[model samples]
Target: MATEGSNSPLRFASVEASVPKITIQFCIQCKWNLRAAYYAQELLQTFSTSLGEVSLRPSTGGVFIVTLETFNQHSVLESHTIWDRKRDGGFPETKELKKKVRDIIDPQRDLGHVDGKKSATNPPAHPANAGHTRELKDVAAQVVDGPVKVSKLQDNRPESLGVQLVQAQNSSKSQDKAECEDCK
Candidate 1:
């Protein structure tokens, strides 16, 4: 098997293109498009290295799968584009993981409630919410004609001060009329 001063053409090609490239192939059902994209993003992060890059260019010819590149370090990825090099490998489709992501991106979450309260965990409440509270109250006031009152809010968190003030003013006016004894 010894050829003097000659490398086989195939061997030469292999050597010339020695930088390992990995092509990962998997079937993704088209129905779950959102889940598919999320999985792709998570998968990319796992394999990203400063050595080169791991990229997924979805195929246009109906063959849809993700590929990874090893930069040809012995090209161990020839068989599988599987890049979980760690002993404790990462799998994307564990049942528990799916549930957690589903909960986080819940589709029906009310935007106002989720982003309303200021908390350490939440991003600061929206800055342009200055007129929101008043708008909400005004909308509510349209249907219900019951006296809407507001109470003093100086020492407490913001609470209604209008209705209470109206009642007090009415009471004081009635008392003045009663004391005057001018009209029954």
Candidate 2:
């Protein structure tokens, strides 16, 4: 009973009604079907289990909008606009779109590369390693037992006053002795 001019997508009786739905409306006059379909496929592939359906609705006047709809316990449908071409400035990038959709349906879910660039050289340190700087520990432990020496202030500035750090000479001698004993 569907007509050719109808923009409504086909639905099945077996489809689950509880899961969140995504609707992407693109301008048919602008020939954006492929672009809309691409976004739909990306969303479905990323959130296969969390989303129920991603419908592509045709529209006119250069309209491109993505919306999410969720059903509450009372079965009241709550709709939120994820992207509006006019309001959002233009179509969203693939990663940005995925991030937005993920935030809406499953906020805790991680989209891997879509999440963002991560520095490989300096990965985030664990909380347990916060106070475990070996160099600082070694330097502090080797401090010579003597009166604290305050050097002459530079440029007559109180902030520039330097505190001289003296390392225990006996500490190096003990380390050398230990290395010799290990060799023996």
Please give the CA lDDT of all the candidate structures.
0.37, 0.73
Worst 10 residues of 2 by lDDT: 175-184
Q: How would you encode candidate 2's per-residue C-alpha lDDT over 14-133 as one tens digit per residue?
A: 645746999999877667789999999999898997898889998877788999998767988899899998898978998999998888777899787777756466677777545445
TM-score of 1: 0.24
Candidate 1 C-alpha lDDT tens digits along 6-65: 775434333343222333332222222344466555533432332133234332222334
TM-score of each: 0.24, 0.53
Candidate 1 lDDT score relative to the true structure = 0.37
Against the true structure, what is every candidate's RMSD? 24.2, 23.8
State the displacement of the C-alpha of residue 148, model 2, in Å, after optimal TM-score superposition: 72
